[model samples]
Target: MGTKEQLLCLLESNRERYVSGEKLAEAIGVSRNAVWKAVNALRAEGYEIDAVTNKGYALSQENDLLSPQGIERFLPRDHPFNLIVRKLVDSTNDEARRRAIEGAPEGTVVVAEGQTAGKGRRGKEFFSPTATGIYLSIVLRPALQADRAQYLTTAAAVACAQAIEHVAGKQASIKWVNDIYCNGKKVAGILTEGAVDMESGCFDHAVLGIGVNVKPPAEGFPAPLGDIAGSVCDADEKALRNRLVAEVLDRFWGLYRHLPDRSFYDEYRRRCFLLGEPIVITRDESRVRARAVDLTEDFKLVVELPDKTRLELPYGEVSTAHA
Candidate 1:
């Protein structure tokens, strides 16, 4: 662990009481002055530490640090992902795409506290007010056929669901394609973009972007979306933000290592709410009413027509499979 992380860990493990500078110095093999310096550094980093004259320092238990360095301390050592925690941005997905063009390594994460231009599935406007949401994106370079790329979206959806459950103790559900639902409302969304490599018949790189609404005003949502949207926290942003990032990334990394697994397809479908619902989807200048028959792993929508005949619709059509 780095010096900053070590100091933070020490403070966190003994949060109940102050750890004297002399004792801390003895334990960490640093001088008392050095311990004092470390404490100052943490304070500078936005950690609310109370410094008592002779008693040393104590981290305020109620202070939840969601800063980049603070989040880094909670991650696994030598984690195979580059995590970028931003205070603000135009959009995490847009930033990740820019990074991909610059040849950023796979698993490079771009997370922001707010997005000025956050968007949702099907070209819907995303509301990401400042310090009120978790907007995140990740770059991935998987050598898989385009035919197999559909599973990547489902994999990421499951990752987000699993992450939310672990971090917030909320049982999140997936609404087909890549939307996470909790408590009868939306919680998060993911978008995937890729570069096709025809020569090698594989995708050179893919970027999966996720935006989780951690907080907003307590009045529910705004205007048209008020009835359709909700937040994880109507009061606490810090706790929700940090936990969402840690859990989402942790789950994403696990499924990403396996890439496009069909076994997870069943589990993902079970958590879906899109299938079996009466819906009218616009496909190529024609709107068709079909019952969602089943969610196929190939990114095809099995929607049964009025005659009960099942027709598989490619994900590219039907606007977006998400509800």
Candidate 2:
């Protein structure tokens, strides 16, 4: 890591108290001049750092800028993540896909504070305002057949929901296939995209993209999403974004390693708000009304049609009939 990165980790770890320049220099094996330079650089990048003449420098407790070091401070020292953070991007998923095509390994993560063209399921626009949301994507090379790739999306939903609850102290629910809800409104969405090796019938690589509304936008949600969108929390706590990113990766990594076991299936089913509710299934141009009855072992939605015919939906879009 560069001097700036080393300094960031140290500051984030000691965010609660100020550390003298001499102490920081000694801890990181750098000179006081270098420490001062790094502090200025961090401030240039939008970090809030306070400098005191005798007490020294301290990272502000309210600093919410996203950084690899900030996220790494909460991650395991040996975690297998190649994290990249951007002030802005067109889309984290698009960036991850490009890296995957260029031979990026598993655990490569792309995170953006804001996106110009955030993507959602079925190519819909995901509202991703700056400084109030988390938009990230992970590149995975799972050893699964093409037919079972949906499991990745389902697993991610469970992971994200668990992370939101743990970090934000809020109850989160899953909306059928790939949405996460809080307080009866959508708070996050996951979109999994991948390519299958035609010869082997297995995935070449999969980019699992997740977008979360950590706090409401300053101007509030757009008119179309005002009724359906919500945030994980109303208070924008410092380090909230960094902690959330690490927690999500940590939880997802555990579930991903045990993909063959499908242990997360139970949690996904339990949190699914659509189960037992009357829903409208949309496939292309046709729509049908059904009551969500259960979830199959493979995470398929088992719904009973109006005629009392049960059907297992391997994949499709669904919404509450009253939505």
- Model number with the top TM-score: 2
The true-versus-predicted C-alpha distance at residue 102 of model 2, in Å, is: 0.8
Give per-residue CA lDDT, model 2, range 56-170, as digits (tens). Answer: 8898878888889889889999999999999999999999999999999999999999999999988899998889999999999999998998789999999999999999999
Backbone clash tally for model 2?
0
- Whole-model lDDT, candidate 1? 0.75
Off by over 4 Å in 1: 1-17, 20-47, 218-220, 234-238, 284-287, 316-323
lDDT (tens digit, per residue) of candidate 1 on 1-323: 55566777788768679988888888787787877788888888667898888887888865665655545555777777787777678878888989998999988988886788886666766788765667788898887887777778888888888877777777889866777888878878888777888888788888888877777655556887776677766565345466578777877788778775665777788887767777677766788777787876665778888888888866643422344
**What TM-score would every model get versus the actual structure?**
0.82, 0.97
User: Given candidate 2, what's the lDDT at residue 320?
Assistant: 98
Give model 1's clash tally. Answer: 0
